[model samples]
Target: MEENNSFSIKNWNEDDRPREKLLLKGRTALSDTELIAILIGSGSRNESAVSLSQRILASVSNNLSELGRLSIPELMEFKGIGEAKAICIAAAMELGRRRRTGEALERKKITSSNSVFEYVQPIIGELPHEEFWILYLNNSNKIIKSAQLSKGGITGTVVDVRLAFKDALQLGAVGIILAHNHPSGTLKPSQADIQLTKKLKTAGDSLDIKVLDHLIITEKAYFSFADENML
Candidate 1:
């Protein structure tokens, strides 16, 4: 999927170009493609970075949203995207996704299950399969760190609550949030989800660390067991 454009960035009037736009309007004003062009740094012999970015977006079904969801290996399918560029794109996309949550995450500390979803959704919501992850928090309820506890079938994935606690203890985490994705886009908490939360809660109780919430993320939304008083 290639569109031949006789006019490249060099042909465009410099004042209206993306680099100029960045300097003038600031980065927030640029679209995803425009930001991507800056990261690309250069295009092929015949094209400019902005042109390359346009072509890359076109190749990915003309969807910048889908491009935001691309895995590193999937991004490498582009002709000029080597390791560094691919990682740069991945990181930028991640940061952009996180920013979409608006200012709620910053105005106040996370207090409930929905708040936990706000943090985890950016990192794993777009995934097509399950990823069970844990957010370790300090006594203040601020997240200290996060780690993938397991990755497999959502309901049947092996989880060792003891091992999870061990990791949290090592980080001196005083609380934790359990998060996992539902590729089927259903937010309903499965029996397995409930069971896992119970295990984590019991373990946290023993360690004097609170289990903040257990979030079930779907493609478009999430469910919080704690919010529903289920946890």
Candidate 2:
């Protein structure tokens, strides 16, 4: 019952092995599969670690974002990948997600619509549903905090203007920017969107908090009310 066709990392040349190649040529020289192979350590007797890693990547169409969405149980469905390997992959992906969030949070000031888009895209743009967010800024226009005011389905979400202003007041923010994403990928603002912006601006005026802009974001592009002279 013994199978003859089997490949192992130990049987490969040192230059071809993932760990050795990484050490000799720098991490960038290793392909995605090689990098993942190093994380899981070894593959089944019938397959090399690189081959197994390739199959896993292939299952997700080689998309890292898609791969990041895979659950540990889903990864464990593959042969040679057990709880330990699955956990390792999940932990690595989570770290990457946190790193992206941290980078976005590190930006000091909001100078334009483009700056706001860059800051909020990683936080909500890629989401499959609608999310309304408010960026609270100090007198110098530096971001004090950003908070999600509401989350809804593909079509739309309800924003509580009261809660948004409450957070701004608590943070002592002198200015606020409103933003939300359309899951449909359309940048055109709805009549409701226009109405909401006007309402928020009026409320801000009463509180002495400036409503700087309202942005409608899709995955690839955005609409800025301020730039359009609608603010």
Candidate 3:
């Protein structure tokens, strides 16, 4: 207990060391702290790597997503976590995020608001400011390409209608979905949001491109203009 907490990995029983345990039982057998300890490589004189990792997780409420949000500097503030360890943890988290994004992009179709939410959430939902994106889709509604059209302050972003349509044309897309994130996490669409949806829909109509939906996304939920009959 206390002995385990104070001792370094070298002093731990072979099976209890993170790397050894992982090799013996597979990655799934290692706890979050153990996996993080492995990334950290070592610990300070006052605590074992596992114990230090436990403290790091505690600082973020044991939420891995929250941990993933930490910058390298923020991670380095933890005892026993130097620049190398901090970068390792941050890089690992980023790789996981990219993997999820790649998986979302590989889906065959954009069939529902929920599907849109899953695809774009990793890209923009948790942003601290507003950003606008357009998903260009083929006639079958499969996403051909997605692009960020603008980024702005907390309240809103400017959407360039012509540029968005130009990208859609270049992609040979027959339809598009508009998306933006509200950093404040409120699902309610602002009056500006309503107006933008109407405007984009009208513009797409002129180009013979359907505006499939406009989604106002937050970290946890989303409001769909089409779902509410607002599009």
- How well does each candidate superpose onto the true structure, as a TM-score? 0.67, 0.81, 0.91
Q: Whole-model Cα lDDT per candidate?
A: 0.78, 0.88, 0.89
Which 10 residues in a row give candidate 1 its minimum summed lDDT? 6-15
Q: Positional deviation of 107 in candidate 2, in angstroms? A: 1.8
Instruction: Say which candidate scores most in TM-score.
Output: 3
Residue-wise lDDT of candidate 1 within 1-231, one digit each (tens)? 454574554556432477777886788899767778888776666676777788788877776657888888988887777888889988987777778654544633667767777777766787766888998888787777778988886344778787899998899988888898987788888887888789889888988988888888865688888779987
* Stretch of 10 with least lDDT, candidate 3: 1-10
List model 2 lDDT by residue over 137-177, tens digit each: 99899999888999999889999999999999999999999
- Please list all clashing residue pairs in model 2, or write none if there are none: none
Quote the lDDT for 46 in model 1: 64
CA deviation > 4 Å runs, candidate 3: 1-16
